[model samples]
Target: MRCDRIEDLLPAYADSALDPRERAEVEVHLASCPACTSLLACLRAADEALAVFPEVDPGTELRGRLVSIAAPRQKFSLFTLLRKPSLQPVLTAASVLGVVASLYLLNPGRRDFEKNVVRTFHRGVGRVEKLYAQAGGITGSIGSFAENLYASLRSSNPLERDKD
Candidate 1:
Protein backbone atom coordinates (compact mmCIF):
# COMPACT_ATOMS: atom_id res chain seq x y z
CA MET A 1 0.00 0.00 0.00
CA ARG A 2 1.07 3.67 -0.60
CA CYS A 3 2.06 6.06 2.23
CA ASP A 4 -1.06 8.25 1.73
CA ARG A 5 -3.45 5.22 2.00
CA ILE A 6 -1.59 3.96 5.06
CA GLU A 7 -1.82 7.47 6.56
CA ASP A 8 -5.64 7.41 6.15
CA LEU A 9 -5.84 3.99 7.86
CA LEU A 10 -3.61 5.11 10.80
CA PRO A 11 -6.48 6.87 12.66
CA ALA A 12 -8.74 3.75 12.37
CA TYR A 13 -5.81 1.52 13.39
CA ALA A 14 -5.22 3.70 16.47
CA ASP A 15 -8.95 3.39 17.39
CA SER A 16 -8.89 -0.47 16.76
CA ALA A 17 -11.77 0.03 14.25
CA LEU A 18 -10.13 -1.72 11.21
CA ASP A 19 -10.96 -5.40 10.32
CA PRO A 20 -8.27 -8.11 10.56
CA ARG A 21 -7.40 -8.03 6.83
CA GLU A 22 -7.12 -4.21 6.84
CA ARG A 23 -5.20 -4.25 10.13
CA ALA A 24 -2.72 -6.74 8.66
CA GLU A 25 -2.24 -4.59 5.56
CA VAL A 26 -1.80 -1.46 7.69
CA GLU A 27 0.65 -3.28 10.01
CA VAL A 28 2.70 -4.50 7.03
CA HIS A 29 2.84 -0.93 5.64
CA LEU A 30 3.69 0.56 9.06
CA ALA A 31 6.65 -1.87 9.46
CA SER A 32 8.18 -0.49 6.22
CA CYS A 33 7.18 3.26 6.41
CA PRO A 34 8.81 5.51 9.07
CA ALA A 35 6.53 8.49 8.18
CA CYS A 36 3.35 6.45 8.80
CA THR A 37 4.58 5.08 12.16
CA SER A 38 5.32 8.69 13.25
CA LEU A 39 1.81 9.77 12.06
CA LEU A 40 0.19 6.93 14.05
CA ALA A 41 2.16 8.07 17.16
CA CYS A 42 0.90 11.65 16.65
CA LEU A 43 -2.73 10.43 16.25
CA ARG A 44 -2.46 8.43 19.51
CA ALA A 45 -1.01 11.46 21.32
CA ALA A 46 -3.94 13.62 20.09
CA ASP A 47 -6.49 11.02 21.23
CA GLU A 48 -4.92 10.85 24.71
CA ALA A 49 -4.94 14.72 24.96
CA LEU A 50 -8.68 14.91 23.93
CA ALA A 51 -9.68 12.24 26.52
CA VAL A 52 -9.01 14.62 29.44
CA PHE A 53 -11.89 16.95 28.49
CA PRO A 54 -15.36 16.05 29.88
CA GLU A 55 -18.23 15.53 27.36
CA VAL A 56 -21.07 18.09 27.58
CA ASP A 57 -24.75 17.49 26.69
CA PRO A 58 -26.35 19.80 24.12
CA GLY A 59 -29.27 22.11 25.20
CA THR A 60 -32.83 21.05 24.28
CA GLU A 61 -33.24 23.88 21.73
CA LEU A 62 -29.93 23.02 20.03
CA ARG A 63 -30.77 19.29 20.00
CA GLY A 64 -34.19 20.03 18.53
CA ARG A 65 -32.67 22.25 15.85
CA LEU A 66 -30.13 19.51 14.95
CA VAL A 67 -32.88 16.90 14.76
CA SER A 68 -35.03 19.16 12.56
CA ILE A 69 -32.09 19.74 10.16
CA ALA A 70 -31.28 16.02 9.93
CA ALA A 71 -34.89 14.90 9.45
CA PRO A 72 -36.23 14.80 5.85
CA ARG A 73 -38.55 17.61 4.66
CA GLN A 74 -41.93 16.52 3.21
CA LYS A 75 -44.25 18.76 1.10
CA PHE A 76 -47.83 17.69 0.34
CA SER A 77 -49.22 18.25 -3.20
CA LEU A 78 -51.37 16.56 -5.89
CA PHE A 79 -48.32 16.38 -8.19
CA THR A 80 -46.47 14.40 -5.51
CA LEU A 81 -49.22 11.77 -5.47
CA LEU A 82 -49.20 11.62 -9.29
CA ARG A 83 -45.40 11.23 -9.39
CA LYS A 84 -45.30 8.00 -7.34
CA PRO A 85 -43.96 4.96 -9.30
CA SER A 86 -46.49 2.54 -7.76
CA LEU A 87 -49.49 4.72 -8.75
CA GLN A 88 -48.36 5.21 -12.40
CA PRO A 89 -49.93 2.01 -13.81
CA VAL A 90 -53.18 2.53 -11.85
CA LEU A 91 -53.54 6.18 -13.00
CA THR A 92 -52.70 5.27 -16.61
CA ALA A 93 -55.25 2.40 -16.64
CA ALA A 94 -57.95 4.65 -15.10
CA SER A 95 -57.41 7.43 -17.69
CA VAL A 96 -57.36 4.90 -20.58
CA LEU A 97 -60.62 3.32 -19.30
CA GLY A 98 -62.20 6.78 -18.94
CA VAL A 99 -61.41 7.65 -22.57
CA VAL A 100 -62.65 4.27 -23.84
CA ALA A 101 -65.88 4.45 -21.80
CA SER A 102 -66.54 8.01 -23.01
CA LEU A 103 -65.88 7.13 -26.65
CA TYR A 104 -67.66 3.71 -26.77
CA LEU A 105 -70.35 4.09 -24.07
CA LEU A 106 -69.47 0.64 -22.69
CA ASN A 107 -72.26 -0.68 -20.43
CA PRO A 108 -71.74 -4.32 -19.57
CA GLY A 109 -74.45 -4.46 -16.80
CA ARG A 110 -77.36 -3.57 -19.06
CA ARG A 111 -78.50 -6.59 -21.08
CA ASP A 112 -79.83 -4.55 -24.09
CA PHE A 113 -76.86 -2.16 -24.27
CA GLU A 114 -75.03 -4.26 -26.89
CA LYS A 115 -78.13 -4.50 -29.05
CA ASN A 116 -78.69 -0.76 -28.76
CA VAL A 117 -75.11 -0.08 -29.82
CA VAL A 118 -75.49 -2.37 -32.81
CA ARG A 119 -78.71 -0.63 -33.82
CA THR A 120 -77.13 2.83 -33.51
CA PHE A 121 -74.10 1.68 -35.52
CA HIS A 122 -76.36 0.28 -38.26
CA ARG A 123 -78.33 3.55 -38.39
CA GLY A 124 -75.10 5.59 -38.74
CA VAL A 125 -73.85 3.29 -41.54
CA GLY A 126 -77.22 3.51 -43.28
CA ARG A 127 -77.11 7.33 -43.16
CA VAL A 128 -73.58 7.26 -44.65
CA GLU A 129 -74.78 4.93 -47.47
CA LYS A 130 -77.75 7.23 -48.20
CA LEU A 131 -75.46 10.29 -48.36
CA TYR A 132 -73.13 8.46 -50.76
CA ALA A 133 -76.11 7.55 -53.04
CA GLN A 134 -77.30 11.16 -53.05
CA ALA A 135 -73.77 12.35 -53.89
CA GLY A 136 -73.55 9.85 -56.77
CA GLY A 137 -76.92 11.01 -58.15
CA ILE A 138 -75.91 14.68 -57.95
CA THR A 139 -72.61 13.87 -59.71
CA GLY A 140 -74.51 12.12 -62.53
CA SER A 141 -76.88 15.09 -62.93
CA ILE A 142 -73.96 17.51 -63.10
CA GLY A 143 -72.27 15.37 -65.76
CA SER A 144 -75.44 15.33 -67.92
CA PHE A 145 -75.88 19.09 -67.49
CA ALA A 146 -72.31 19.72 -68.64
CA GLU A 147 -72.80 17.42 -71.69
CA ASN A 148 -76.03 19.22 -72.60
CA LEU A 149 -74.34 22.63 -72.28
CA TYR A 150 -71.51 21.47 -74.61
CA ALA A 151 -74.11 20.19 -77.19
CA SER A 152 -76.05 23.46 -77.11
CA LEU A 153 -72.85 25.50 -77.61
CA ARG A 154 -71.75 23.31 -80.50
CA SER A 155 -75.17 23.63 -82.29
CA SER A 156 -75.12 27.46 -82.08
CA ASN A 157 -71.41 27.88 -83.04
CA PRO A 158 -70.67 28.92 -86.71
CA LEU A 159 -67.01 27.86 -86.25
CA GLU A 160 -68.14 24.35 -85.30
CA ARG A 161 -70.51 24.22 -88.36
CA ASP A 162 -67.70 25.31 -90.70
CA LYS A 163 -65.54 22.56 -89.32
CA ASP A 164 -68.25 19.99 -90.09
Candidate 2:
Protein backbone atom coordinates (compact mmCIF):
# COMPACT_ATOMS: atom_id res chain seq x y z
CA MET A 1 0.00 0.00 0.00
CA ARG A 2 1.10 3.63 -0.62
CA CYS A 3 2.25 5.73 2.40
CA ASP A 4 -0.73 8.13 2.09
CA ARG A 5 -3.26 5.26 1.90
CA ILE A 6 -1.56 3.61 4.89
CA GLU A 7 -1.68 6.96 6.78
CA ASP A 8 -5.45 7.29 6.08
CA LEU A 9 -6.11 3.74 7.19
CA LEU A 10 -4.01 4.21 10.39
CA PRO A 11 -6.87 5.95 12.31
CA ALA A 12 -9.34 3.19 11.38
CA TYR A 13 -6.62 0.58 12.13
CA ALA A 14 -6.14 2.07 15.61
CA ASP A 15 -9.93 1.95 16.07
CA SER A 16 -9.92 -1.75 14.94
CA ALA A 17 -12.58 -0.90 12.30
CA LEU A 18 -10.59 -2.44 9.37
CA ASP A 19 -10.87 -6.04 8.10
CA PRO A 20 -8.00 -8.46 8.94
CA ARG A 21 -6.53 -8.33 5.35
CA GLU A 22 -6.52 -4.46 5.23
CA ARG A 23 -5.12 -4.27 8.78
CA ALA A 24 -2.29 -6.66 7.84
CA GLU A 25 -1.45 -4.48 4.76
CA VAL A 26 -1.38 -1.28 6.88
CA GLU A 27 0.76 -3.02 9.55
CA VAL A 28 3.31 -4.02 6.87
CA HIS A 29 3.46 -0.42 5.57
CA LEU A 30 3.69 1.01 9.10
CA ALA A 31 6.62 -1.37 9.88
CA SER A 32 8.50 -0.05 6.77
CA CYS A 33 7.54 3.69 7.17
CA PRO A 34 8.84 5.61 10.24
CA ALA A 35 6.65 8.72 9.48
CA CYS A 36 3.44 6.63 9.40
CA THR A 37 4.51 4.76 12.58
CA SER A 38 5.03 8.13 14.35
CA LEU A 39 1.58 9.32 13.12
CA LEU A 40 -0.05 6.13 14.44
CA ALA A 41 1.73 6.66 17.80
CA CYS A 42 0.38 10.28 18.02
CA LEU A 43 -3.16 9.04 17.11
CA ARG A 44 -2.99 6.39 19.85
CA ALA A 45 -1.73 8.93 22.42
CA ALA A 46 -4.61 11.36 21.55
CA ASP A 47 -7.11 8.50 21.73
CA GLU A 48 -5.75 7.47 25.17
CA ALA A 49 -5.90 11.13 26.41
CA LEU A 50 -9.52 11.41 25.25
CA ALA A 51 -10.43 8.10 26.88
CA VAL A 52 -9.05 9.29 30.26
CA PHE A 53 -11.72 12.03 30.49
CA PRO A 54 -14.63 10.73 32.60
CA GLU A 55 -18.12 10.92 31.04
CA VAL A 56 -20.44 13.19 33.00
CA ASP A 57 -24.25 12.80 32.79
CA PRO A 58 -26.14 16.07 32.99
CA GLY A 59 -28.89 16.38 35.67
CA THR A 60 -32.50 15.74 34.53
CA GLU A 61 -33.35 19.47 34.68
CA LEU A 62 -30.26 20.43 32.65
CA ARG A 63 -30.95 17.68 30.09
CA GLY A 64 -34.56 18.91 29.75
CA ARG A 65 -33.41 22.53 29.26
CA LEU A 66 -30.83 21.46 26.66
CA VAL A 67 -33.43 19.45 24.75
CA SER A 68 -35.87 22.37 24.82
CA ILE A 69 -33.21 24.78 23.53
CA ALA A 70 -32.12 22.41 20.75
CA ALA A 71 -35.64 21.50 19.55
CA PRO A 72 -37.16 23.60 16.73
CA ARG A 73 -40.47 25.31 17.57
CA GLN A 74 -43.25 24.89 14.98
CA LYS A 75 -45.15 27.98 13.85
CA PHE A 76 -47.71 28.86 11.17
CA SER A 77 -46.16 30.87 8.31
CA LEU A 78 -46.23 31.25 4.51
CA PHE A 79 -42.41 30.83 4.47
CA THR A 80 -42.92 27.32 5.88
CA LEU A 81 -44.45 26.39 2.49
CA LEU A 82 -40.89 25.62 1.34
CA ARG A 83 -40.16 23.32 4.32
CA LYS A 84 -42.37 20.53 2.92
CA PRO A 85 -40.23 18.06 0.88
CA SER A 86 -43.05 17.05 -1.51
CA LEU A 87 -44.13 20.61 -2.36
CA GLN A 88 -40.64 21.80 -3.38
CA PRO A 89 -41.18 21.12 -7.11
CA VAL A 90 -44.70 22.62 -7.01
CA LEU A 91 -43.45 25.80 -5.29
CA THR A 92 -40.52 26.12 -7.69
CA ALA A 93 -42.81 25.74 -10.74
CA ALA A 94 -45.29 28.28 -9.35
CA SER A 95 -42.47 30.80 -8.69
CA VAL A 96 -41.05 30.42 -12.21
CA LEU A 97 -44.51 30.69 -13.86
CA GLY A 98 -45.38 33.78 -11.80
CA VAL A 99 -42.13 35.56 -12.77
CA VAL A 100 -42.57 34.65 -16.46
CA ALA A 101 -46.24 35.77 -16.51
CA SER A 102 -45.38 39.05 -14.78
CA LEU A 103 -42.50 39.72 -17.18
CA TYR A 104 -44.69 39.04 -20.26
CA LEU A 105 -47.52 41.29 -18.98
CA LEU A 106 -45.22 44.10 -17.76
CA ASN A 107 -42.76 44.28 -20.68
CA PRO A 108 -42.80 47.82 -22.16
CA GLY A 109 -41.66 46.71 -25.65
CA ARG A 110 -44.39 44.05 -26.09
CA ARG A 111 -46.72 44.89 -29.02
CA ASP A 112 -49.01 41.83 -28.97
CA PHE A 113 -51.65 43.67 -26.87
CA GLU A 114 -51.56 46.58 -29.32
CA LYS A 115 -52.08 44.13 -32.20
CA ASN A 116 -55.09 42.63 -30.39
CA VAL A 117 -56.58 46.13 -29.86
CA VAL A 118 -56.09 46.96 -33.56
CA ARG A 119 -57.71 43.64 -34.56
CA THR A 120 -60.71 44.40 -32.31
CA PHE A 121 -61.06 47.90 -33.86
CA HIS A 122 -61.00 46.44 -37.38
CA ARG A 123 -63.64 43.83 -36.45
CA GLY A 124 -65.87 46.61 -35.04
CA VAL A 125 -65.52 48.55 -38.30
CA GLY A 126 -66.46 45.45 -40.32
CA ARG A 127 -69.56 44.88 -38.18
CA VAL A 128 -70.61 48.54 -38.67
CA GLU A 129 -70.13 48.15 -42.44
CA LYS A 130 -72.46 45.11 -42.44
CA LEU A 131 -75.05 47.09 -40.43
CA TYR A 132 -74.84 50.01 -42.84
CA ALA A 133 -75.22 47.70 -45.87
CA GLN A 134 -78.24 45.93 -44.30
CA ALA A 135 -79.96 49.30 -43.58
CA GLY A 136 -79.36 50.37 -47.20
CA GLY A 137 -80.35 53.97 -48.15
CA ILE A 138 -83.17 53.95 -45.55
CA THR A 139 -80.66 54.44 -42.68
CA GLY A 140 -78.17 56.73 -44.46
CA SER A 141 -78.40 59.33 -41.66
CA ILE A 142 -77.99 56.65 -38.96
CA GLY A 143 -75.09 55.08 -40.92
CA SER A 144 -73.30 58.44 -41.10
CA PHE A 145 -73.94 58.94 -37.37
CA ALA A 146 -72.60 55.45 -36.61
CA GLU A 147 -69.57 56.11 -38.80
CA ASN A 148 -68.87 59.35 -36.91
CA LEU A 149 -69.19 57.54 -33.54
CA TYR A 150 -66.75 54.84 -34.66
CA ALA A 151 -64.21 57.46 -35.86
CA SER A 152 -64.51 59.36 -32.55
CA LEU A 153 -63.99 56.16 -30.48
CA ARG A 154 -60.90 55.20 -32.55
CA SER A 155 -59.40 58.67 -32.26
CA SER A 156 -59.98 58.86 -28.48
CA ASN A 157 -58.30 55.49 -27.79
CA PRO A 158 -55.13 56.00 -25.65
CA LEU A 159 -53.11 53.44 -27.67
CA GLU A 160 -53.97 55.22 -31.00
CA ARG A 161 -53.13 58.60 -29.43
CA ASP A 162 -49.80 57.24 -28.17
CA LYS A 163 -48.92 56.13 -31.71
CA ASP A 164 -49.38 59.71 -32.97
User: If scored against the real structure, what TM-score would every candidate get?
Assistant: 0.39, 0.33
Off by over 4 Å in 1: 1-109
Clashes of 2: 0
Clashes of each: 0, 0
**Model 1 steric clash pairs:** none
lDDT of each: 0.90, 0.90
Stretches off by above 4 angstroms in model 2 are: 54-164
Over 28-134, each residue of candidate 2 has an lDDT whose tens digit, in order, gives 88888999999999999999999898888888999999999999888788777668899999989999999999998898867987788899999999999998887
By TM-score, how accurate is candidate 2?
0.33
True-structure lDDT of candidate 2: 0.90
